[model samples]
Target: MITFQLSKQEKVVKSINSPSNNISHCAFLACSHSPQCTTQNKTCCAYILKHSLVFIDTFFKHHNLSYVIIYGTLLGAVRNKTIIPWTKDIDIGIIDMTYLFTKKIRDELYQHGFHLFESFGLPRLCVHKNISNRTLLATYDRRHKPPASTLELKVYIDLYSMYRIYGAQTTSKTPVFLIKTGGSFHALISFQNRVTIDEQTFPTIDNIEEHLVYFYTKEYMHGIMTE
Candidate 1:
């Protein structure tokens, strides 16, 4: 197995091959009646995404970490009150990466019925809910099963590492700032701005329209397809 090193001594192991295999089962936790929960019932998918957002928001607030909703998640929050009806996964960017993999965080997550996993160097916050052991025991092949001691994966929220870069000027008086997501830098996002959805508030970037345009071009205002 491959391990992704975060710092001098901290590392995360790739426990699961692909998280997508279990994402479909998340809708069962929300509403079990539909076999094709994601496509047949869009509300079930949105419910899972909203639940993840609320939990992560509370977790970050308790730890006093700075974060913002980005990508498709941000677009939904700005245009609609909640996540996009069709979206199966949620994306969030946290400013602090140094403290993410500490033992304290792991302990706290375990206490709250959550687990952390890493894939391709990106962290994922997974919740343990209605997923059954029997379902998880069946891995890539239905004919074979892993050890009964194997842990299960439920619905998860994707976490991206973010950093702030200062000293950039824009057309507006406000000092144009940039947020570094992975290796690329994006323009104009402030943590000071906040948006509320379903009575739950989240930190967001300023100049929503302009930032959306920067990422999605001029046609972004009308709403476009997002994964």
Candidate 2:
């Protein structure tokens, strides 16, 4: 059974329970180029993205927190009805609720087989799966060679904090919400209403096309299609 022990700041420590080896059906060996292999791999990745979203949706709902799909993940959902074939990570934005419950969220992700690691620095969490200690060592070892083991090493999801900018100069045209990425960068986002993906609706930015233009250049649609 999975359990959580929270520190004063609510940082989660590893539990005594060992991580599970029962990989989900979405886990794939790696990507390949032969037409058949490419198709199968893309299908597998799309399934994983869908499953990951379901878990995220359930978690946020249980916590009574509001979240929205964003970035490249949203583009894929809106345009292709699935994850972009070349995309490696999922992105979501939560409105000012994650900080207070970091440990709880980390523990929950751990229970579901995700290993949380800091990206850019400590406390900014990026959760991943199918990445063992051995794989991590191989990544940094100079002598280690490719074609490396691809037991789903890159399945990860990024969580962004959404906050409203409050100040005297802020105006209506100023975005209602800011989605903070790692470090100091933030992307402006506005929530007009919701968007449906795989028949489940979730909040999204108003004028998604405009937001997409801001986040990606005018060539965004063309670029995403190439790979």
Candidate 3:
């Protein structure tokens, strides 16, 4: 029998190639499901929120388009002055835009490493990051699984189209603004104004509290805070 000795470089390469050493730093920590990993996940989500907002603001400004903070995101901005801890996404509404615009926005996002997914039959745009070889592991609770591939990319910005409803009895062609929610479009007649949240300014309904109640009901606010 002949015995062979491996060189330093060969040894290092062999160790790296071993199955035990193949685990990625992120994958190892994420798989552990420890509190530290949970905190890291939240931190990653926060970064995504900040970066996504900046990207959206830049894109809209370049396109000469205006967007309004709406839904839960609007509520968080108005009350907490920051993103809600439990909030997983951002919501914004564009007035008088068509679904065709989403295609353009998707293409623009692709250039910046984001992939756009449109909800079927709804004027909604969800953006995610492109990644490879990532799999979501079931959590201890089984209900909450950490985002598999796009660790920091789990956060998404939702873009909704606002339209003005045309009443059957009215003959005037004046444009109106309506927001779609729960599979139906509701009239939005509130005046919009600029508001600053976490040093970033965006358009929101002038009467924010009332607007939120109108869309989500007073009980919804209570539930959000309590739950």
Candidate 4:
């Protein structure tokens, strides 16, 4: 069972219950092309990611919280006009992290049919109620178990806090900062760029080419990811 625990400051629990391994339809690998994948099924992982991002974007806007898509999620958005066919989770950076820990936000998430949980040692928000099939296939935790009576799939959205690196002190003389989570830098980004996909606009780094090159090198424009 999923445990819902909340501290005075931290509003989420440790992790979710293990999920079953009966998802034969889940490829867990990037699709050769996203256009072919998303059109096939509504409950597919790609659609799950799309819907998850839409919800978060709307949620943050409604609460007046500033956020931007970053890392692989941003890359896919800029390149494919959709999430990477093999996207396992969503990544976003909030301008203010403290707002996420308040009791009000916690209640709002729960009221919206989501259970915030920690996975991979980092906090992530997840929901299963919005999807048509009502299944939650835990992406990272695939342990064999008797099929529970609840949903069989879980879509997790990883959250990171954005910070400004004040003062320009680089050789190129442009301010650059790192988005860190769990003591590791998620991405090196600068400036803000507005991106529109499928008529839905979202914020990203203005220098997207540099952002992609900084992480994926020049080949990213061709839809190649080299870590």
Please give, for residues 119-190, the per-residue lDDT of candidate 2 as tens digits: 432222222333342222222223323222223344456666666554313334535555555433333445
Clashes per model (N, Cα, C within 3 A): 0, 0, 2, 10
Which order, best to worst by lDDT? Answer: 4, 1, 2, 3
lDDT of each: 0.55, 0.50, 0.48, 0.56
lDDT of 3 by residue, 1-227 (tens): 11123211211101112221111212211123122222224334443454557666787778777677777778767666656656656788776354224446546655654444433333333332232312221211223443343233235566666654444222233333455555443433344476666778776654566566766677655545511
User: What are the per-model C-alpha RMSD values against the true structure?
Assistant: 9.0, 10.5, 19.8, 9.8
Assess every candidate by TM-score.
Answer: 0.65, 0.61, 0.58, 0.66
Q: How close is candidate 4 to the true structure, as a TM-score?
A: 0.66
Model 2 steric clash pairs: none
* Cα RMSD, model 4: 9.8
Pairing residues by index, what is the TM-score of model 3? 0.58
- Candidate 4 lDDT over 1-227, as tens digits, reads 11113212322333333341123323232222344556135545666677668878888889988777877788877788767666556778776666776667766776664545544555566553332334333232334442232233334577876665554344443434446554433233443557765568787765577666667777786844521
Per-residue accuracy of model 1 over 32-137 as CA lDDT, tens digit each:
2122343223235566567667777898889988788877777777776667666645778776755766767855764665556564556676544333332321
lDDT of 1 at 55: 72
Candidate 4: 10-residue stretch with minimal lDDT: 1-10
Q: Candidate 1 — worst ten consecutive residues by lDDT sum?
A: 1-10
